[model samples]
Target: MMEATTQAEVTAYWNARAPAFDGVASHVAQGGVWRDVLAAAFGAGGPRDVVDLGSGTGACALIAASLGHRVRGYDGSEGMLAVARAAAEAAGLSVSFDAAVIDQAAIEPASADIVTLRNVLWTLEQPMVALAQAHAALRPGGMVLVSDGLWSVAPQFRSTYDPALAARLPWHGGLTEADARRMLAETGFGDARSWQHLFASPPYPGDVPMFVLSARKA
Candidate 1:
């Protein structure tokens, strides 16, 4: 139960964090493995049209592009997009980056072969709206790969969090695997399936399970 954040506030927050966020890759030891996981999740033999919403520093976009998929990344933070652009240019990868609010982010109707949202859903004010937009952007039978986890719901996590601080933070808490499946189904997606893994990142406790929720446009 955190206070609602305005679009401007969200944008500003991420913009200020752009520099540190750009350095995120250094923390991950298995970039190649993660990329392969993503590739397989989206299906192989790609040269597919992919749109990554809330793409941030373009982790998903850059990796997918490397695998020969056409990619377009959208983020609310211009700072993040700037970092993503520089990385793409340095890597000699062709990725189109745009700045747009999460709820307003869009792509051509039935044009995308896949849509990805990684480490992004929990920050959204209206996760369902983003899902609906993803559903609309994808072609019939297109797949969506959503990665998220229950960060704040863990007992160990709760022990460390100050009650007052937790109550005020903008985090949307966690969305469990079952909750993800239900959300996708309700958003006009079908064949919803999910699995969990032990994933860790900076400033967070280890052994927390991250969930990947996959489904296709019906």
Candidate 2:
């Protein structure tokens, strides 16, 4: 289990990479994992009260809102949250953005029908704790979705990222499919499953996997 990430480091890292991250997002929406991730997460469900954790720039949150899900986005980075707010406004959608860590977030328990933790599991210092918090935030029979997969093959990882990006990459908690499911289950989630699409072969982006870990409060 990883310890809590310092706010300063996380802020500095994201602050420095904000522009690069935004550029990547635009590119992803054009032809990449962004659409697939959003589709897999929201396309199958009806309108839901959704929370997009680590929702940088409101891509998923805005999309979900457009699909009629009342969405709230959470992130630890203020700079990122600013971008998300602007994006939401530009889309003419109303989404509540929370600038806080998962555990420290002010959201009450059993308030949301679905809680989204996209591309954040592997980046968190305390993934299990984050899942537990998400579980608590959702209503009975709510859902939690986690997505990640920057690298599928070992040698291929080197080709995708340079040293700085590689070093500061979202999180150190990257787990395989089995471990990911196990983490959710261990943290009080039921019916955990992972789905993935490997787009750029092994030497590029690897697999953009989706882990939808859902549970009904018993």
Candidate 3:
């Protein structure tokens, strides 16, 4: 579990990285194939409400907004939210970006059609709690889309975080698709599915294999 003191350190770590976060290719919103993948995960049925947890720089939130979905993005770092808000404004997209930790966001119960967490689960000290929050925030059949990979495969990626802070995070090394599905299911989700084709080629440097897992609330 993430104690209050550790949580503060985690937020500070992300806040420090916010300034250059979007400089990375995967952190920014690139349309085309990325857009297609997101659209498919969101599923078709008109614009739906989306809640993006740990939505750094609003990449996923902006993309979701561009796809015409109502979106609210939350993160523990105010610096990240600032960046996300600026990006949303510059892109002419309307998205609510607020400061809220993943496991503790005050999302209304059964209020969203979809919940997303991209490359975020691995950083959490309490990922299961975050998943439970996502499940609670969704309508009965809402979907939760989680994206992450074996980031530890690259020493450079692991070196980005403070050693002490990294030691506190449960999945600082990263997580697998099977880990994601099991976590979702344990949190009361069902009909889990995953896609890795979109990222057949690494989106960024390193040989990290990324994946997107979508599961429905039972």
Candidate 4:
């Protein structure tokens, strides 16, 4: 299990990287690809309430807000939240960005229509706890959208974190679509589904395998 000290280390690591985080293609709002992908996953909806956990730089949160959804984004790194808030202001998008750990975010139960975890699960110390939090945050029939990749295969994965700390993360090596689906189901979600075509031609290098998983609250 991840200790409180290790969690603080993880947050510090992310805070150090927050400034240049958006330089990565996948971390920013990619013209139409991300917008379209989120729209499809969110389904036909009108101004739904969205809670974005691990909302680094507010990419997905901003996109969701732009699509008319009311979005609240939470991240453990204060530096990241600063960047996200600045981005939201620049985009004229009304998104509330707060500092909070993924698994311990202070959100009201069943208050959200959608919860998003984009490329965040693999880095989490307790991904199952985060999923449970997502489950509790969503209203009945609400959706949780998760996007991540087989980051272990990427050449730079080893350099992204401290070797010792990385070794402790449950999914630091990465996870598959099947793993995500199973986790969602185990967390009391139903109608779980996955998609891969959205990342068939990744914008970044390494050709890391990516997937998008969406499931409804049971």
Per-residue alpha-carbon lDDT of model 3 for 1-218, expressed as tens digits? 46888789888988988898777655443445677788877877889999999998888899899999999999999998999999899989999988988777788899999999998888888889889899999999899999988888886754257888888888888888888878888998996887667654666468786778899987
Ordered by lDDT, highest first, the candidates read: 4, 3, 1, 2
Higher-scoring candidate on TM-score, 2 or 3: 3
TM-score of each: 0.84, 0.78, 0.94, 0.94
Q: List RMSD in Å for every model shown.
A: 4.2, 4.4, 1.6, 1.7
**Higher-lDDT candidate of 1 and 3:** 3
TM-score for model 2? 0.78
lDDT of 4 at 158: 33
lDDT of each: 0.75, 0.66, 0.84, 0.85
Report the error of model 2 at residue 74, Å: 0.9
lDDT of 1 by residue, 1-218 (tens): 11245456666777887877755433145566667677668776739999999898888899989989999999999998998899899999999999986566657788899999987777666778888889999999898888876776564542223344334434456666777888888998987765334233422345445677789997
Q: Which ten residues in a row have the lowest lDDT in candidate 1?
A: 195-204
Give the lDDT of residue 187 in candidate 3. 92
Candidate 2 lDDT for residue 8: 56
lDDT for predicted candidate 2 compared with the true structure: 0.66
